[model samples]
Target: MTIGVLVLIIISACSRVDGEMNRVERASGGSPIQVVTTIGMISDIVQEVGGTEVVVTGLMGPGVDPHLYKASQGDMKRLEDAEVIFYGGLHLEGKMTEILEKMENKKLTVAVSKDIDRAVLRSGKDAGGSQYDPHIWFDVKHWISATETIYDALVQYDPTNAEQYKKNAETYINKLTELDAEVKDRILEIPENDRILVTAHDAFGYFGEAYGMKVMGLQGISTASEYGSKDVSKLRDFLVENKIKAVFVESSIPTKSMEAVIAGAKEKGHSVNIGGELYSDSMGEPGSDADTYIEMVRHNVNTIVDALK
Candidate 1:
């Protein structure tokens, strides 16, 4: 069923936690405010800001693509149980946009990207599609801004714990601020000519704009756009013409298209290596180096810098 239909069907049958009850229950010593996030990035930020006062459950995990992810039955229950819901917004969760929007009427449903400055974003059309680019996390400064948004949502819901949330947000935002600087410095490690970042899709436009790299992809902004041989030929031609040495594959996307581009480039004697796998639409697994938002950014930076430099 379409998410729009699901929003009408299942949601009408579900009720949300009452605001007064939420405050009283917490005041009377109840469970942490149940916070649900659509993607791991937002989940990490909400967890960092909410700290002990919130229980954050992310619907999309490592290697999951938020651009095309749909709400499953279990996901619906999780949303129903949440006191607050945070999503990447900007149509990042394209299929779930309606449900997420309607969820706001009953609870503190937030699109963290909504708090971002529109000036910094690349439109999907700009990136090769229709909506605004949703990969804001690629820009650490933007993600730090998003952290503040998550912090505000938590404080709005649970004002009693505002100070703690403030402390956590400050700490996390400071780290992100440092990360923003580090990414810029690291990107400089590559020669200006080699700073081109080619990936499976145009998911790195924000990264390119923020960190000073030229980005290209076999597919458009969203993976929903199917790639054709023409797309591969074009990218392959560009790689050969530019003498681009490497391309990166994204964890959430299948590697076949990129592999095809690499093969086609080889046919023309332009040997291009798969630079490395990047955490584009998803984070890494638990216990992995890119497990958290900060680590994920670190891993991507190191991978891109190491390969291109």
Candidate 2:
């Protein structure tokens, strides 16, 4: 395949997680709670809680890398009409960092992921080689906190539904708790020796921490980072030495690095398989099995368990 086509194939694997799809007219009526989020998963969570009460839109879509995304005319229209804007903060949206800052003063925009404890955030190489890793949704617990923050924002926007929002948040949190348990149980089914997780990017630190598995990615959390030859060689060594059964690719990032890893392992007389595509950066397209936040987590667990067990 041509490089572009290969990239498309990798991204299409993640098409399962692109939750914010082409606009659908939301249920008309009680009150329009316009919410603008950075990606589809957040939009899905807002819809789950806001129900038919909120109208939501997102700036990023399937295969659209958020680190490099630039808001277009359509985004401006969405922002102008929104009652509150919700984004995954901690530098997840790289280019729109400034836009999110400016919106803080004008709109009721909040970085819903801020509720996560700083200790849980992974650091970037700056400010003494430490900056927060912004992919907080990888862990269901952190997202549970984010859901609470979202509930507060929704209540703030439309207090009339405060009771309803709280109830919705509780319901969602319970589901997340169940998801957390399910993922752990599934990962436990993998033999202890095969519990290592290798992927295209380092977006699963929280997932590793939560599930008692080790995670290694060829690139950084953001797809903007190109996988270095050294990293790939190192990962190949790790996979071989540990006898890792499967190395997975992510839905959003290119899987060339993963292919390189698999090839390198084969060269050393160790065999490994590409487990399956994982939903990392975003959720699936609307109406697909992995579209919603809960479904996204469940599907990921099922895929991982099936492959690694």
Candidate 3:
């Protein structure tokens, strides 16, 4: 459905729920804080930091692309009901940014990545040169910063559980620290010459910068941008020159573009293979090795190391 129609429907549905929401909010002393997050990454962090004090509803699930996601009627209702909404800003939710911004006046809407230092963020020329990469969760340290943001937001909205939120943030930060160290160590297994990552999109710039890999993408930072014939040819030539054995695909993006790249490289006398599917904009299915953020990082690192080493 068109976003305009979706918004209208949501407004109507929300008006009906307004009275009931007020009643629930009045009795919220014993209930969890109602929260809505744009993507799984934000949802997971909020859940970890909020603990028993919050109930998070993630709008985008596993293998869903935030860049291309639009709010459904159900998603709009969820946002209307939420006491607070968290999203990975920097225009990650390109289609839903307007609605989220409009909701801010009515609710405690926050961009989890807002607290990140601009100096540390990777600025790109894509999207009219004003965009910073929104995939901050790829870098463990950056994500640790985001965890603090989520914790602070939770505390601000629900001060009664400030102590619990602080504790949860501390524990999760420690885990992220250890995960960062582990990723570095595992990435060391691949030789420097093979420390190049060619993926479906430029979603891994932060990851490449953190882990010391030269990253290239078939498309720009936002998957919404298209790649031309020249772009594909240039990437293929780079693959051939470097003798790179593997190129990776993303879970949320179609692999056809990467497959085309592989075929082009073969035609030019290079035999590059599909390394493995990487969770770029989204995590794996629940109960899988990459279900959580930590596990997702581990799975991606293991995949890259095994294929490149």
Candidate 4:
């Protein structure tokens, strides 16, 4: 079905659930907030801060690309049932923006990165003239700020659990702070000249900015955009000239583009390898170390350092 039809169905379903929303509480007797998030990163923070007080469901899973994600019937049902919905905003969910905006009026829909300073956001080079990058979770410090945003939203939604949410936010933020320091130290092991992070797409602009690395991507910030021969040739030339040993692939994006770049570089006499698969738009699977936000960041950093250092 078309997105508009799906949205209409969801709107109809939401109206039906709106009346019964008051009857649903925490599975237990307490006031547990029902939360739905667009991406795993936001879901992790909500789960951490909400703890037992909230039942959080993430719409996107490991290796799921949010930019191309569409609202499924099941996803719409989940949104209809959820008391609050959180997303990464800034056009991250380009396909579902209109539907999400409509839901905001009916429920507590929030953009977790809404309050971030515009100065910190990377400008998009895509056709849209004024879009900003929405991958805020890459920078640990920005992710910490997002935790506060999540905390405040949770507190506001479930005032009874405000104190608990605050405590959880504090603990999670501290963990992120330590993670920030650890990532910096790890990156330092790599020589400054080798700090170029070439990837499948421009998802890591925030990461490169925060961690002192130069990031280049074959595709634009959003995976929805396509790369032409010129883009590949330019990136290939860059890798050849820099003698960069590695270019990484993203878990969410196809490796064909990076492979093409590597081949083009090889023809130009530069031997570049796939450094490792970085978690660009999504985390890893549940049993893996990169399943959680902290583990995902650590894994990406270790992969980069090991390959580039």
Looking at candidate 3, what is the lDDT of residue 85? Answer: 89
* Candidate 2 local lDDT, residue 218: 86
Candidate 1 TM-score, true structure as reference: 0.94
Ranking by TM-score: 1, 4, 3, 2
Write the number of the candidate with greater TM-score, choosing between 3 and 4.
4
Q: How many clashing residue pairs, candidate 2?
A: 7
- Residue-level lDDT of model 1, residues 1-309, one tens digit each, is 675556545555345536456756665455789989988988899888988888889999899987788889789888877888999888788778878888777767899988887876787774324468888888888898898888888777777788899999999888888888988899999999899999999998889998899999888888877889899999999999999988999999989989999999999999999889999988999999999988998999999999989
Model 4 regions lying over 4 Å from their true place: 1-31, 127-130
Off by over 4 Å in 3: 1-28, 128-130
lDDT of candidate model 4 versus the reference: 0.86
lDDT of 2 by residue, 121-195 (tens): 777542112278777888889988889999987776677777888888888889989888888888989988778
Please give the CA lDDT of all the candidate structures: 0.85, 0.77, 0.86, 0.86
Of 1 and 2, the candidate ranking higher by lDDT: 1
Per-residue lDDT for 1-309 in model 4, tens only? 666556656577656566345434422247667899999999999999999988889999998988888888888788877888899888888888777877776767899988899888888757133278888888998898889998988776677778888899999999999999999999999999889999998889999999999999999888888899999999999999989999999999888989999999999988999999999899999999899999999999999999999
After best superposition, candidate 2 residue 192: deviation in angstroms?
1.4
- Backbone clashes in model 2, listed as residue pairs: 14-251, 16-284, 17-283, 17-284, 18-283, 18-284, 124-131
lDDT of 4 at 199: 94
Clashing pairs for model 1 are 124-129, 124-131
Steric overlap count per candidate:
2, 7, 0, 0
lDDT of candidate 3 at residue 184, scale 0 to 100: 97
Instruction: Give model 2's TM-score versus the native structure.
Output: 0.87
Which residue ranges in model 1 land beyond 4 Å of their true spot? 1-20, 27-29, 126-130
Candidate 4, TM-score vs. the true structure? Answer: 0.93
Q: Which ten residues in a row have the lowest lDDT in candidate 1?
A: 11-20
| Error in Å for residue 3 of model 3 | 5.4
